[model samples]
Target: MTRHAELVVPGGRYVLRRARIPGCFLHAPSAFGPADADGSFLVDLLIDNGLVADISAAGASMPADGPAIDLAGRQVWSTLLDVHTHLDKGQVIPRAVPDGTLEGGARATIADRQFWTEEDIAARMRFGLQCAYVHGVSMIRTHLDSHEHLAPRSFQVFRAMRDEWAGRIDLQAVGLAPLAVFRTDWGNRLADLVLQSGGVLGGVTDALGVYEGAGDAEMDRLLDAFLMAAAERGLDVDLHVDQTEALDPFALPRIAAAVLRTKFKGRVLCGHCVSLALQPDDVARETIARSVDAGLDFVTLPTPMIYLQDRKPGRTPRWRGVTLAQELLDAGLKVAIGGDNCRDAWFPFGDHDMVDTLHQSVRIFHLDQPFSRALAMAGPMASDIAGAGRHGRIAVGAPADMILLSARTLNEAMCRPQADRIVLRRGKRVMDPLPDYAELDALAGMPA
Candidate 1:
């Protein structure tokens, strides 16, 4: 079968003709009938005024007043959501190289901060957002480093871009501050900025030991301050927790306990938590139980973790630097996987492609036992965690945010390069030109 070129809907009602979307992909189970002998069912989707108005059996009579594009049995899936990414620091590789350690990456990133003009940050962030949009991602939540000197400028650029891309893609920001700063005037200032820009409060848990040299009592004080501030400001909290291989001084349980004690009403999301994988089975189970009790959500960024964890010069690594995702999911916690960094100083690899992240996650986390569940790590589950509860699902009355794939099966969808895919935002096909690397380089004041 020949792939269908993307149909540009020129802003109005339209009908997707004879599309064969999978039953598993539908939000409503009854939308599609049982598959035929070839494991496929044909349907027609009517999208009107930026919503799915109707879905009927294939060849059903429908209005052809607007335009009708034949899908030719191509599979349709929800566009992806990325809950954890570093847009402020993306696409700055080779220019700012890390020494292949987490500490080294932090140092290198801080050193490169001298060159972070607002224009430079905006250009790099726009480049990453464009890549994500073309790759069929409808929403993203990026973390911006929130030092006292840098955060105001970073938030300024991010807020402007949030408006700039409002219709095409939803952008949410998190102020990635250090926990040690939470009790200081600087922390209050950061909270004010976050509240002004409608962003979440974020911090690094592992940094308590590495950067601040904070012991147990001090860690508790810092965490309490952070949670209290977030509660006072009515903001959600997203934390980078236990991002190291060391099993001792585990911060996940402490964080969960703090959330419960502080009675934080907003959502609490924890990223990384790699040390959970190294814990004894019973201890890990207890930690998961605590997290569930505290109403915590998780996002695992396997690519960066795998790149930075368990690495010593000229030696084979012992463990993959990822969290216990399977355990968390099996325990009924909401776990999502994300593409953490794209071409950044910290582990220089990744495009902002959630499909690629899902494919890799299926391998790294052993998620292919049941294909549908594995796919959810990047789809509906991730969308819900990103606070886009109505997106990443196809149903009557839902926003027409979807992707048309050329593949017939889930395996094909994961394995094949999706070059021929068409992305839709609010029922309209997105046809923005992909950004050129040379152009981005020029914008960043780098040689092409």
Candidate 2:
């Protein structure tokens, strides 16, 4: 069949034989081939007309009809989902590299926003999307800076992109602003704009610039108002909460309380929560339990968390920092890991690669004992959090978009970036190379 194991699909239909897939990525792993040591099982995927026709046990039957890509036990993953990212801020490192701290990053970003004309934002964002797609990421939910003046420009660019990247990469936008804004008349307008653009209602509970600690009655009022705004419009909410090393700014529990008290209907997504790791066990447990009771979803940005949470001039960090992902996952809340920022002031690193994001997450969150569940954070779990379409899992009759890895085991896949990995869309090889950073040279330089 077709030159002995080469990736050549005949007429948009073929069989990917001897393909290894992680158990967690499959909807029905029990019915597949026997599991290997790392929980991956071999199976043959029959792709027809851009959809998975069937997944039979490896070598269950002969493919006497058409081309068969003999993968020879290569690992396969469903195209990934990235629930939290900053596309508006992506690729700005050249102009806005921060001092590698949250405050510095925020200040640098605000300074850079003065130059975010629609053309500049669109070019950088389009570049980010191409990078994500080339690396096999199928769905992305990017949080846009939704200040009154910036919202119009950023949301407009995002709306155009959400339509343009419609089929290739399921793009979702979340209007990200500070919690205090929800109490303003402009906040109502912002919510309306988000609704008009089909975007999520999102805010940072404490932007560090405004510390809304627990027991702050004003914080509660603003939060409840924010939730109500989203609820009335049938919109989902995502918030940046507790993104600091200080123990006082405990906004996550407050968020959970607001959600429960308001009985908000829309799905809630909370990001960062880095300070949760610093809380005492009892406090952390109670907060996590409340989150579960409120049915809240979480996204951890480990890459940015570690870089920003513990940084200081002379002293080394007392403890490694990130959100309590392990505990949240154990509590049965939908916890996902995200590439929070890429080549921006936030982290000044990353290439919009969700696979790399997942790889970083496994180490940062200690999710590799199984690695399958960790993979799901960037895959199915992420899709659920973003409310993006269900391309995150490999299922019967699912789109044939997936990544084929030369590594058969999770360890091998994790050892390196898996640079040799091949991305396939609609069961065919994607030949679009990752975008070069030089393409955005015109958009570089600080505003006068």
Candidate 3:
């Protein structure tokens, strides 16, 4: 209770100890076996069946000399939740990032990365899944492109991952089709394919931006058809909506209106409402208010948006492709940040950890200027914003999924994150750190 210790729990080592608790009612650590507020309580931890269930005081008290784990005062918060991601089709163009594009600099991304075999996807999923575990991302909603009628093959790979990792990670797969692909009736088969393949029903709106001709209206109709099919099948929806300078704020409002009318509000997640960033503050506020009022959850991809933005000189360039993250928070919207791409054509590099994504976001949004706030944001605050649920906290009933850090305080742990930060999927031991975050950093650009 007052020292550094690690006990073998599900998935990995269970490290527990004392620390200054964050000043939030929801985040206070609880005592085991009912004690005075002043006395410290045991914090049981484990990752099993894929969920983090920390049952320190369930029906028993700590034995006088039984097994114990001191987390070295490191915080044991709930596992992280990354509500938005595209693990299957990263970079939309993976091989071209480091080498730049054929046009001298980096080539612009049109569709997601292609030419990946099922083996390639499986390998990528392995890396992404493992990295996600270490970074405390216990849950992920990933979109996989089904553009070339690849859902049959791709879904097979994702299913294997889901079956293999089961409780280790809550993985949701979405079938993605570009608006152009949809209008040409290419996605028609893909939608039905995703339905049969048993994945989430999802699509992209910005793909509509690239539409050239009479294809535009037809694409809209296809999107509607896809949404309807998803609804008929009782599937949730996520869309890559309004992702360019050409996107109008009204476009998202229109979608929100449709969702409201269809009563599919909470089931719909609208990603990268980039148009919100271009609008006036009031207008942006009102637009999101309507969407949230209509029950649309939001997913912001800060890193990729920053990576893709035209940082060109002057001209009052108007596209950032990021939703109003902090502003949406201020509006009490259910919003979470996700790593949109890793080493893909869109973003040449991403370490695959939610912490990395969170770190970048803090810097981009000026959330880390104070330093101290940045550390806390990496854990508690990040969890809250990203729907870590009862996760991202060290409380009763929260998932036992946790990371054991090397530092005692929040600051030290973040400044030097470690693989020693044991990752627990539930109550089962999954991995022990022969190598940690240090090695992970050193071996950058490798698989995951």
Provide C-alpha RMSD values for all models, in order: 2.5, 2.2, 6.2
Displacement of the residue 249 alpha carbon in candidate 1, Å: 1.5
lDDT (CA) per prediction: 0.83, 0.85, 0.58
In model 2, where do residues sit more than 4 Å from their true spots? 1-11, 207-209, 212-215, 444-448
With candidate 3 superimposed using the best TM-score fit, by how many Å does residue 238's alpha carbon deviate from the native? 0.7
TM-score between candidate 2 and the true structure: 0.96
Best by lDDT: 2
In the range 1-448, model 3's lDDT, one tens digit per residue, is 4323354542333323332333221344344444222222334443334443344542254333433454544544445667677677553233444332212222433322345678667766777777677566777767886657576787889888988887667777788765556555655666666667666677766544343343444545655665666776767777888776554424577667667656662267778777778877777777877877777767778777765554454444354457776776666665666777776665667756776676666666665434334333444544554344555555544555555555555455445645555555554444533223333232323345
- Candidate 3 off by > 4 Å: 1-15, 19-62, 91-94, 98-114, 180-188, 207-223, 247-250, 313-321, 368-399, 409-414, 427-448
Candidate 1 per-residue C-alpha lDDT over 1-448 given as tens digits, one digit per residue, 9 for 90 to 100: 4445635555468898777665545655444666643344578889988898988878766786778777777777778889999999988876788677888888888887877999989989999999999999888999999998999999999999999999777888999987878768998889889999999999988763243666777778888999888889899999999988888678999999998888888999999999999999999999999999998999999988898999999998999999999889988988988999888778788889888888888889887766667667777788778787765777789888888887766677778877778888888787887777775656443545
Error of 2 at 121 (Å): 0.5
Question: lDDT per residue, candidate 2, 1-448, as tens digits?
Answer: 3322255656477888899999878877979867888888899989888888898889887476888778888799999988889999989867887798888887898899877999999999999999998999998888998889899989889989988998789888899888888768988899999999988998887756354443578788988999989988889998998887778767888999998899898899998888899899999999999999999999888887777767789988776678888999999999888888898987878888888888888887788899898998888888877776666888778888889887768998898897767887877778888998778877848433
| Model 1 segments more than 4 A misplaced | 6-11, 17-25, 35-42, 57-67, 208-211, 443-448
Q: Rank the candidates by TM-score, best first.
A: 2, 1, 3
Relative to the unseen true structure, what is the C-alpha lDDT of residue 88 in candidate 2, on a scale of 0 to 100? 94
TM-score of 3: 0.75
